[model samples]
Target: MGQKSGGYDLNLFANPPNCNFVCSVCHGVLKRPVRLTCSHIFCKNCILQWLARQKTCPCCRKQVKRRSLVYVNKLRKAIGRLEVKCKNAEAGCLATCPLAHRRRHQDSCPFEQMACPNDGCSMRVQRWALAEHRRYCQHSAQWHCPLGWLQ
Candidate 1:
């Protein structure tokens, strides 16, 4: 999902498909994902640090190759796996979900999402990305790591 300089071209992420992979950390379904050259998928930061420390695929424990790691695009995957609902709990949003339901859910899930409060970090990521956010937020006194830690 690299972007060109002229303008934001999100063509690669124009769509998504449904999926499920074990959370690399807790082995949960909810860990955010990324694809590796081995075709194995794992949570974003999970594999990064996993690679940093292990340098092997979390799934197969094989040596990870170069730059093949990338985030699993939610919008792209939602097309197949997501089930849409009205998202309004009280309204009983039983409208029957569509493939494009994730972005809406991220914006609507009462218990699944939250926006980063960093003054300029405009990311509305899942709860896990919060630790990644706070580590790099310019406004947070506790921001650490030599790297900015954004992905």
Candidate 2:
């Protein structure tokens, strides 16, 4: 009972503030949150700036404008009530974060690792730069030995 009460009380303050949505710009916690009549929501500043540069929702290819926009505090608060989890699929990371701001956790998560495609480099690298490393891995063994060697 105490835990439940605490959960509700904590949610009263927007306890969690992580979002799973990918930011269109800045790639941060999207400043000035906003929502549309279509139920699609995004950062107000992001939308406005996007509208200034181009008029359309990044997630949905629907027409959007500043005039048809409205603040969605209720939704935002509701989002805060949710738990966030690692976005790194395939990985066994079971971390749970808030619904408002899980992106940051996944982006900076340490468990997220990838194999170094260096023939047999046997190195675990972060997910983001995995492609570059794989492409230019010095350990990219040109010769394949029977004993399973990298470079």
Candidate 3:
């Protein structure tokens, strides 16, 4: 469970999770985990997709039926409390947030790098700095008027 995959080590959080909490299919933090009648857990979507192809528990290979799946709300809440590094950490973002909020935070993270809006400028700017960069960007002069247009 400590192994790295897709730039994230699911077991490296402030509160390390047991192997049971990791999704076998994606090998990542279990998002919306569900439990099978066989007592094995998997991400809800993962197991659904797996069941679509084969009707067996991924871990024990026990025969499973779609109706036997149950949402693991307690486990999901526990995982949500664990603190994890932002996915953009390598991009200079140093924030850490709860697993439940990680996706939302990443979507609005100020440190996320984005391409300059000006047609000729190739500079990459952090999301927080994009507005300032656009203000003085020389290439923007062609499309942006400093004075208000009367028409």
Give Cα-based local distance difference scores for all models.
0.53, 0.59, 0.79
**lDDT per residue (tens digit) for residues 1-151 in model 1:** 1212111111212233223434445443333467788878765656666677887886787788648777667623633354444434343333445434545654645444567887766777555457776766666656665675534
Error of 1 at 151 (Å): 54
lDDT of 3 by residue, 1-151 (tens): 3333221356446556777778888787787888999888888877888899998898899999999899999999988888988777777778888888888987899988889977889999889999988876777854444574422
Per-model TM-score versus the true fold: 0.38, 0.36, 0.72
Write the candidate numbers in order of decreasing lDDT: 3, 2, 1
Better of 1 and 2 by TM-score: 1
Clashing pairs in 3: none
CA lDDT, candidate 3, residue 77 = 92
Tens-digit lDDT track of model 2 for 1-151? 1221111222322233344432444344433457766666666766676678877777776887679988777655655546745655346565677755666776777667877866658888877667666666667655434466644
**Which residue pairs show collisions in model 2?**
17-100, 17-101, 18-100, 18-101, 19-100, 19-101, 84-97, 84-98
Number of backbone collisions per candidate, in order? Answer: 9, 8, 0
Off by over 4 Å in 1: 1-20, 30-32, 70-81, 84-151
Best by TM-score: 3
